[model samples]
Target: QREFTQKKTFTSWINSILAKHTPPYVVSDLYTDIQQGHLLLDLLEVLSGQHLPREKGFNTFQCRSNIENALTFLKSRSLKLINIHVADIIEGKPSIVLGLIWTIIFHFHIEELARTLACTYNQPSLDCSSAVDSSPKASRSAKKSARIKERWKMSATKALLLWAKEQCSLHGSVNVTDFKSSWRSGLAFLAIIQTLRPGLVDLEKAKARSNKENLKEAFRIAELELNIPRLLEPEDVDIVNPDEKSIMTYVAQFLQYSKNLPESEEDLQEKVREAMGWLAAQEKKLAKLLVETENETYYQKCKEMMSFMETFNQEKTPFLPVLSSKRGEAELSEGQQQMREEWDKVVSQINEWKAKLDQMLPSPLDSIEAWLQEVERLQAEDLPDLQDPFKAMSVFREIIVIFKGLMDCFDSHLDTLQSFKNEDEKNMPLVLPEKLEEMKRRLFSNIRSTNPSTFLEYHYGLCSAIANEVKLKLNICDVKYGAKESVESLLENW
Candidate 1:
């Protein structure tokens, strides 16, 4: 038949390629051992793309005899070398075992030979052939093949676990003295295992395994042997701080890194929370120190009022006398001239007092007026709003600090005004009680209520905006993930 001729040609081509690539020692061994000739033939058939040979029918009896002979020869002559070579090949190559399994089923119409080979090396035999008919024998063979395939898969899983352990040992010895290096090497080993057996490395599978006390104890022993660290390294710690920008950056990086960690690592999450709390305490301490410093400065300035009053009295006394005695008719003209001179001196003294007040008080009223005008200009300009919550919060906090500073200054100004009022009442002939009372009321009102109202309004607006943004973000997450549970898991992990 045409199929037979094609197969013969294919086999010849494969033989040529194998003869060119195979080592001379292996070829010599194959030729010297006639009993192992079937092994070479099977390898050549697999390489020649002969998955299911239709011609030159081989029955189960013939296939079993050849397999037994091959097994006996390998056991007697080269068992150790054969084991090493097979392990190395399985580790380095893909689908070789599967191809051999398929070839066995193709020639024998039975799965036992492949199953026996898989058992020899404790590997799983993959079933790669379909039933040719629906006879009772075929049905029984299908059932056996299915069972063998399941066993093979389990064997492969165990093999992968053993390989992972072996790799861990080969990579490095884990101990407290070299925890970081050892741990990193162990992680690399796990990564390799994951690449090889992704389905077996899942947390769900691990949880299932934990149900068996023996397996759970095995895992604990492995963890102990690997010397996995209970605590993170210093360089891995991310602490939230008062520097908002830096804190944001640190948190983002921490969230990203945490995503790569196993979801069951609750202890690591707790450690992160503890670090953040410690950093927050530090920020609180700094805030308290700042408040104390501001208070001390305000009190010190208040105590300097006595010296300032003394200076004011000394400057005023040179121009204004405490009292003027009545003058007789003979001295009336001289008194009138003296009165004009006194008036000129009083005017000059008032001018000097006004200039001194300008320098000392530097009325915030003018600054406030300018600020209001600027606010109006900004409102008219309709500038774009800030998009980031952290940035907006920073601006809001700065505004609150500025407003508080202004309020404190207003309080100090009021204290100074009251001190001046008391000094004037005690030493000067003139006092403007109504004007001072009105100014005091206006300054106190601005300090206590007016500025606070502005602060509250701006703060509320910012909070509402941030809340809306958070809601929008939540909605987007819901849409993307499509389930509340998944969203919660994502956020919790994040």
Candidate 2:
């Protein structure tokens, strides 16, 4: 069932990409069309913008060779293929072919969507230098930006997940954690449509409906209102396990539609400057908040966090439309990139502070599940790479202490759960104790496996190599024709 849907969805998606070529290519039959490997090579070339070598012969060996060449190209990009072989694709193995096409869609389409979300329609390239000042000083400043955009890259799976999560966060109680079961209730789709095109889906009505009903309506509205292709039926997604690939393909269309919103260069630049100013202001406010709350009490920190969240929503929510409108261009400028880096720092500090406060607070059995989830989230986050050893070590020690406290907190909660196990089942959740025990075992296993010494050693090595690389250039500044070169001119040229 899923294979059929993926084939249809992926075929349309492939033809969409191929349609942009000089002489457009279309895949009528996904399984057999690529058996000759010419179309496969064409598709790869179209996706990657890289010319690939292919066999022009009609022989089976030549066909297999072409397929192998495509496989090799995929491998060169560091894409790990599991149980996928050249013979499977050459033979037109249905499942294998579907998997191969899905991989291509995930890599070239879905993964690339995040970076392209900020660009206008038909504008894939993000080099909008003319949108800002093109003076030598501005150019030099642009070159020195923090490269903050690179940090936002994630796997295609994670990119879709983050987009869904961000969209669903605006709606009520629609938490999109993963691609599979998260959309089972169908509220996620509704939330996405409602947020993207306001008033498209009625949340109050959708809430009262059954899963299948909501799923059907969301798909209908998305297709009718947004012109998004109906890639999946209610029965397909409202299942015990919905197909992640199908949902991603369908959701990616929304991202495509989102980037096409009309805005003039003048308006876009004005919005960009406005967003830059807002982010700059936020950086200052968050920096001050971080310092003030550094040694504050748990209650004080909680108060600050709550107040910050309110202020954040009020101030930041207004800019979301413009930010989403020109997301790609926002990170391309010197001022925008610097502001984004500071904004990223602000977010990182908030997470760190939240983790600290969580450790200081106590949790009842009812809220322990939420607490555990938060702890797991915090633990799953990788430590940031700080060039300064002092900064890195300080952060490492603070996190370690919070984690240690969380372990103790978990133990204390576990003991409480165990005590209530013999009590009435109605008053307490029967599965809570077993669930906590399982979680505890996993948490402890992870903690035991983690060696802090290894991290510290790695950090030490990174610190030593911080300034190992340098880009040095010597330029001769010759003032000619009795005209003296200004200091600004020399600095800009330098």
Q: Estimated TM-score per prediction?
A: 0.21, 0.54
Per-residue lDDT tens digits of candidate 1, residues 1-494?
A: 32222223223323333554334222222212222235444553443444322223245445445544434433443232223233322232223332332233223311222333333233221110111111121112211311234234323322222222222221111111111122221242232233222322332233233223323332333235433211122122112111221111212222222223342335534433443343344345434544454534322322332233334323322211111111222433443334434433432333343333323332443343333323322222211134554565566666667655555565456566666533233574222343345345444432233423335545666887778888887776665676789877988975
lDDT by residue (181-265, candidate 2, tens digit) is: 7788889899778767776677768879999999999989988998776777888888766677888888888877776766566
Which residue segments of model 1 deviate by more than 4 Å? Answer: 1-357, 360-393, 409-416, 419-426, 429-435, 479-487
List where candidate 2 sits over 4 angstroms from the true fold.
1-5, 18-29, 49-62, 72-83, 116-154, 265-320, 323-370, 373-380, 383-494
Of candidate 1, the 10-residue stretch with the lowest lDDT total is 125-134
Best lDDT goes to which candidate? 2
Counting clashing residue pairs in each candidate, in order, gives: 1, 2
Model 2 clash tally, residue pairs: 2
